[model samples]
Target: MSEVYDRLRGEIVDGTFETGAQLVELALAERYGTSRTPVREALRRLEQDGLVERGDRGMRVRTRSPEEILEIYEVRISLEATAASAAAQRHSEFDLIRIRRAQAAMDSTSTDDPAAMAAANRAVHEAIWVASHNGTIVDLLTRLNNHLTRYPATTLKVQGRWAEALDEHRALIDAIEQRDAARAHDLARDHMTKARDLRLQIYREDPTA
Candidate 1:
C-alpha cells in the first residue's frame, strides 16, 4: 500500500500525471501493474494529502490558485526562517557539507536548464531543512513543498531568477556555517519572499496557469 501510494504521489508531484489529469483507478492499476484495490487505496491517500481533488471532472490532480500559492508561501516564510535559524545553531559539520554540496551541484548544472536548476535548488533547501535537526519543522516544510509543486513551472525559469537564487542560496549557506542564527533567519525569509513574488509573476503571465 505504501509503495503504491509513494509511486502515485511521486508521479503527481513530478508532473508525470499532470495537473487536472483525471486519475482513474482502473487505468492507474493497469499502469502500475497492480490490482485496482491498491490503486484505489493510493488515490484515497492522495486525496487526503491534497494532491488529488474531486470536482465536476471527478478525481484529478489538484490545481492551486494564485491566492492559494501565495498563502502557502506566507506560511512557508515563517517556517523556513525557523528552520534556518535552528540550523545555524545546531547543524553539524556534515550537515554544512551537505548544504554546500547541494549548492555545488546547482552551480555545475546549466542555468539554461530550468528543470535541472529547480531540482538542484530543491536539494539545497531540503538539505538545510534536514540540517535544522527539527523534526516538526522539517515535516511541515516537506508537506508545504509538495503543495507548491501543484504548479509545475519552476520559479527559476523567471528571467534572471536563476542566478539571483543561486547567490541567495550561497549567502544562506554562509550564514548557517557561521552560526549566525539571526542572519540565517533573515536570509531564509528574504529568499522565500522573492521566490513567492517570482512565482506569482510567472503564474499571472500564463493564462493557463
Candidate 2:
C-alpha cells in the first residue's frame, strides 16, 4: 500500500496525472499491475496529503487557484529567506557540498529537459532548508513545494527564464558560501520574487494554464 501510494504521488508530482484529471482506480491498478485494493488505499492517502480530492465524477488531482498560488509564494518567500539567513550562519562543509552538487546538476541539465531542471532546482532549495536545521521551516517549505507541483508548467520552461534563474542561483549560492546572512536573505527573497512575477505573467498569458 505504501509502495502504491509513493508511486501514485510521484506520478502526480511529476505531472503524469495532470491537475483535474480523473484518477480511475481500476486503471491505476492495471497500470501498477495490482488489485484495486492497493490503488484505493493509495488514493485515500493521496487525498489525505492534499494532492487529490473527491469530485462529482471521482477522485481528481487538486488544482491551485491564482489566489492560492499568490498566497503560497508570499509564505514561501518569507520562510525561504529566513532559511537562507540561518543556513548562511550555520551551514557545514557537507551542506555546501550538497548545495553545490545540486547547482552543478542544474547547470549540466539542458533547458529542454524541464523535469530534470525542476528536480535539480528542488534539490538546491531543499539542501538550503536542511542546512538551516530548522524542522519547522523545513516542514512548511516542503508543504509549499508540494502544492507548487500542482501547476503543470514549470517556471524553468518559460523562454529565457532558465538562464536568468541560473545566474540568480549562482549569486545566491555565493552569498550563502560567504556567510553573508543579510545578502543571502535578500538574494533568496529576490529570486522568489522574480519567479512569482514570471509565473504570474505566464498565467496571465495563458488562462488555461
Candidate 3:
C-alpha cells in the first residue's frame, strides 16, 4: 500500500496523472500490475494527503481555485519569513553551507531549462527551512509546498524573475550569515510576495500554469 501510495503521489507531482484526471481503481491496478485493493488504499491515502478529491463520479486529482492558491501563498509567506528569522538566529555553520550549496546548484542550472531552475530554487528554500531547526515550521512548510506543486508552472519563467530571484536569494544569505534575524525575515517575506504575484500572473497568461 505504501509503495502504491508513493508511486501515485510521484505520478501526480510529475504530471503523469494530471489535475482533475479520474483515478479509476481498476485501470490503475492494471497499469501497476497490482490488485484493485492496493490502488483503492492508495487513493484513500492520496485523498487524505490533499492530492485527490471525491467528485460526482469518484476520486480525481485535486485542483485548487485561484483564491485557494492565493490563500496558500499568503500562509507560505508568513511561514517562510518566520523560518528565515529563526534560521538567522540559530543556524549552524553546516546549515549555512547547505543553503549556500543549494544556491550554487541553482546558479549552475541551465538558463534555458526553467523547470530545472525551478527545482534548484526549491532546493534552496528546502535548505533554508531545514536550517530553521524548527520541526513544526519545517513540516508545515513541506505540506504547504506540496499544495503549491499542483500549479506546475514556475515563477522563474516570468520575465527577469530568474535573475531577480537569484539576487534576492543572495541578499537572504547575507542577512542570515550576518545573524540579522529582522533583515532575514523581511527579505524572505518580500521574496515570497514577489513570487506570489508572479505566479498569479503566470496563471493568467497560461491556462496550464
Number of clashing residue pairs, candidate 2: 0
Query: Which pairs of residues have clashing backbones in candidate 3?
Result: none
lDDT by residue (tens digit), candidate 3, 1-209: 88888899999988898879999999999888899999999998787767899988899999767786789899999999999999999999999999999999998999898789888999999999999999999999988887877888888988888999999999999999999999999999999999998888877777566
Candidate 2 accuracy as TM-score: 0.84
Off by over 4 Å in 2: 14-18, 22-37, 55-58, 207-209
Tens-digit lDDT track of model 2 for 1-209 = 88999999999977788778999999999999999999999998788677999999999998767787799899999999999999999999999999999999889987777778888889899999999989999999998887777775788888888889899989989999999999999999999998888778777887446
**Model 3, residue 113: displacement in angstroms?**
1.5
Instruction: Return the TM-score for each candidate structure.
Output: 0.88, 0.84, 0.93
Among these predictions, the greatest TM-score belongs to 3
lDDT of every model, 2 decimals: 0.88, 0.88, 0.90
Q: Least lDDT summed over 10 consecutive residues: which range in candidate 2?
A: 200-209
Model 1 segments more than 4 A misplaced: 1-7, 10-18, 56-58, 207-209
Clashing pairs in 2: none
The candidate, 1 or 2, that scores higher on TM-score is 1
